[model samples]
Target: MALVTTTEMFKKAYDGGYAIGAFNVNNMEIVQGITEACKEENSPVILQVSKGARSYASHTYLMKLVEAAVMDCPDIPIALHLDHGPDFETCKSCIDGGFTSVMIDASSRPFEENIEITKQVVDYAHKYGVVVEAELGTLAGIEDDVVVSAEDSSYTRPEEVEEFVRRTGCDSLAIAIGTSHGAFKFKPGTKPQLRFDVLRECEKKLPGFPIVLHGASSVPQEYVHMINTYGGAMKDAIGVPEDQLREAARSAVCKINIDSDLRLAMTGSVRKHLVECPADFDPRQYLKPARANIKELVRHKIVNVLGCSGKAL
Candidate 1:
C-alpha cells in the first residue's frame, strides 16, 4: 500500500486504547530498521522527519528513503510526517512534497499567533489530502532543532484545548505533560510523573479528538550503560518511565514520539561493535549491529509500551 494519513490510525488507536509509534528517521539504516520491526510486529508506524534532519539529509533523500520503505513493507500502513515544523513554509513544503502528515509546532508563540500559523498550514494541507498536527504546550530539553529550557516548558492547559482545536482546525494536538525532549528527561533521583489529570481534562473537553505526546522516548538504561562501557560518558541520561508511557497510551494519546531511544540503541550498538572489533573497519560491519539493535528496541516498544503489536493485521 502507499503512504497513508494518520486519521484512520489515530481513530483506531483512540478506540482500541493504544498509540501508534512515531519514530524519527534520518538515514537509510534507521528507516530500514524501524519499518522492518513494524512489519514483523504487524503495527502501523509514523516515520517523522524534522527540519534539522532535512538539513542534514536533504529532503529529497529522506523522501526517497521513505518511498523505499513503503515498497519494501507493503502490508502495514505507514505515514510520512514532518515533526516539529517551525513555520508555515516548512509545513507547506512537506505537504507539497508528499508528506502524509505535518506538524506545525507554534507552541512557543503567543496563543493567537500559534492559532493563526497553524490554521494557515491546515488550510493548505487539507487541499492536498494531508493531515496536520499542532502543538499546544512547550516541551523541555533538546530534540534536533527543538530546544526549550525546563523553566520555559509548561504543561498544556486543558481549558485552551477546545478553542485551540476549533480555531486551528488541526487534525491532532500535541500536549506537554512532563515529557521532555532528549535523553535527560528528568534530573537524577527524581521520579518522573506525567500529569494524567491534565490529560484527562483535555480528553473531557475534546472527547473523541486525537492527542499526541512529543519527547516520549523512554531512554533504556541498558543502552546508556553500553555507551558508557564503550568510551562514552553520558551521565544521568534518563527518560520517561515505560509504565507511565503505557498509561498515556491507554488514554487519548494516539501518537507517541520516540527519537532518543532509537539514537541511544543505535549509538550504543555501534560503539560496542567498534570497541570489540577494532580490526573491522567496514561501515556495514558496525552499522549492521546498530540496525539490529534499533529493530529490537522498536519491537519491544510496539509490544510492551505502545501495545499496538498485531493491530496492523
Candidate 2:
C-alpha cells in the first residue's frame, strides 16, 4: 500500500481511545526496527523526519529507506512525515518530495504569526493531498533544532484552539501540556505531570480534532541504567511518566512523538554490546543488538502505552 495521511488514523484513534506512534527516523536500523515492530503488532505508524535527521541522512536517503519499509511491511499503513518543520518552505518541500504529512512548527512565533504561517502551509499541503500538523504553544527542551527555555515555554490555551484550527485548516494540532523535548524533561526530585485540565478543555473546544503531544517519550529507566553502567554519564534524565502518557493517549491525543527514548535505547544497547565484546569492531555486531532493543521498545510502546497494537490492517 502507498503512504497515507493521518486523517483516517487519527479518526480511528479518537474514537477508539488510542494514539498512533510517531517515531522519528534517522537511519536504516531505526526505520527498520520501528516498522518491523509495527508490522508484527499490526499497528499503523508515522515515520517522521526532522531537520537534523534530514541533515544527518540526506532527504533522498530517508525517503528511499521509508519506501523500502513500505515494500517490506505492506500489510500495515505507514506515513512519512516531516517533524518540527520550521517553516512553509520545509513543509512544502516535504509535500513535493512525497511525504504523506508535514508539521509546520510555528509555535515559537507570536500567536497571530503562527496562525498565518500554519495557514499558508496548510493551504499548499492540502492541494497536494498531504495533511498538515501545526503546533500551538511552545515546548521546552532540545529536540533537533527546536529549543526553548523553561521560562519561555507555555501551555496551549484551550480558548485559542478553536480559532486557530478554524483559521489554519490543519489536520492535527500539537499542544504543549508540560511535555518537553529530550531525556531531561523534569528535574531529578520533582514529579512529572501533564496538565490534563488544559488537555480536557482543549478537547471540549475542538471536540473531534486530532490532538498531538510532542516530546512524550517515556525514558525507560532500564536504558538509562544500561547506558550509565556501560561507561556513560547521563544525569537527571527523567521523562513523562508512562501512566501520564497512557492517559493522554486515551484522550484526544492521536499522535505521540517519541525520539529521545529511541536514542537512549540504541545508545544504551550499543554501549553495552561494545563493553561486553571489546574485541569486536564490526558495526553489525553492535548494531544488531541496538536494532533489537529499538524493536522491543517500539513493540512495548505499541501494546502498553499507545494502545494501537492490532489496530492496523
Candidate 3:
C-alpha cells in the first residue's frame, strides 16, 4: 500500500532461500519498467536512487515518480532506496524524503572510518523508521558516484565483518566477493566467477544476517550484440554469471544490485529502433520500446535470478 522497508523482505528471503532484486532507477520509464515487472510476477522490489540519478533528474521528480508507481501497483510491495549514498547527510536527507532504506557506501575508506560513517548514518536513519545498508569491502566498478579501479579492487576482510556489523548496527551488509562494478566486469577469454568460499565465510560469521551483492549484473550478450549491431561499441563487457548469482541468492545474499544490465537493455533497444527508423522524430515511440525492454529484463531477473516471485501481495 505504501513504501516498505527491506527488513521484512530480507528476512523472508533469507528464510526462503531467495534474494531480492534491487533495481536502480533514474527516470519515469525506468521506474515504470521495473515496477511493471514486479507487479506482473507478484514480487516485491527495491527501487534504488543514486546520487547521480538525483543530480540528473532532481530529487522531487524521482520521489514523485516512485509515489506514482505505488499508486499504479497497490498490490505489490515496493521500497524506495537511496543507493551508494556518499555520506551521512545524503542518507539522512533521503530518509527524511520518504525513502524506506538507504545505503551508506564508505567501503573505500579505512575500516574504522567506514564503521564510524556508517554508524552515523544508521543513527540518523533509525530515527525516521528507515533501514540502513552499509558496505564493508571496497568493490571496483564504474557506477554513478561509485568508481574504483580494478587494481584497487579487494575482497572484504572476513574477520572484520563481525566487528563491522556489530559496530555499525546496520540492517544489511554488502560485501565484495570478487564482483566488480560496471559493464566491463570481466575481460575477454576469462571466465567470470564468484568467490563463494568468501561469501560462505561471511554467512557463517553473521548467521541469519542479510548479505548484499553490489555490481552483480549478468550483462546479457544479446544486448551487447544488439548495441554493437546498432552502431555501439562495448567490447568484452562481461558480468557475473546468472547461475552464480542464483546460487548466491539461494544462500545468504538477500539483495542483488542490478543497474548495468538494465541500462544496456534500454540502450540497445533504443539504438535498434532509431537505426531502423531514421525518420522517427517522436521520442515516445523509441522510449516506449525501451521501457518494454527494461521491463522484460526485470521480469527475467525475478523469475530466474531472484526466486521472490509470487511472494508479494
Q: Give the per-residue lDDT digits (tens) of candidate 1, residues 1-313.
A: 9999999999999999999999999999999999999999999999999999999999999999999999999999999999999999999899889999999999999999999999999999999999999999899999988889999999999999999999999999999899999999999999999999999999999999999999999899999999999999999999999999999999999999999999999999999999899999999999999999999999999999999999885
In model 3, where do residues sit more than 4 Å from their true spots?
none
lDDT per residue for candidate 2 within 228-270, as digits (tens), equals: 9999998779999988989999999999999999999999999
After aligning candidate 1 to the native by TM-score, how far in Å is the CA of 13 from where it should be? 0.4
TM-score for each candidate, following the candidate numbering: 0.99, 0.99, 0.99
Off by over 4 Å in 2: none
How much is 10 displaced in model 3, in angstroms?
0.5
TM-score quality measure for candidate 1 = 0.99
Lowest summed lDDT window (length 10), candidate 1: 143-152
Model 1, C-alpha of 272: deviation from truth (Å): 0.5
Candidate 1: Cα lDDT at 87: 96
Model 1 ranges off by over 4 Å: none
On lDDT, the stronger of 1 and 2 is 1
Model 3 — TM-score against the truth?
A: 0.99
lDDT of each: 0.96, 0.95, 0.94
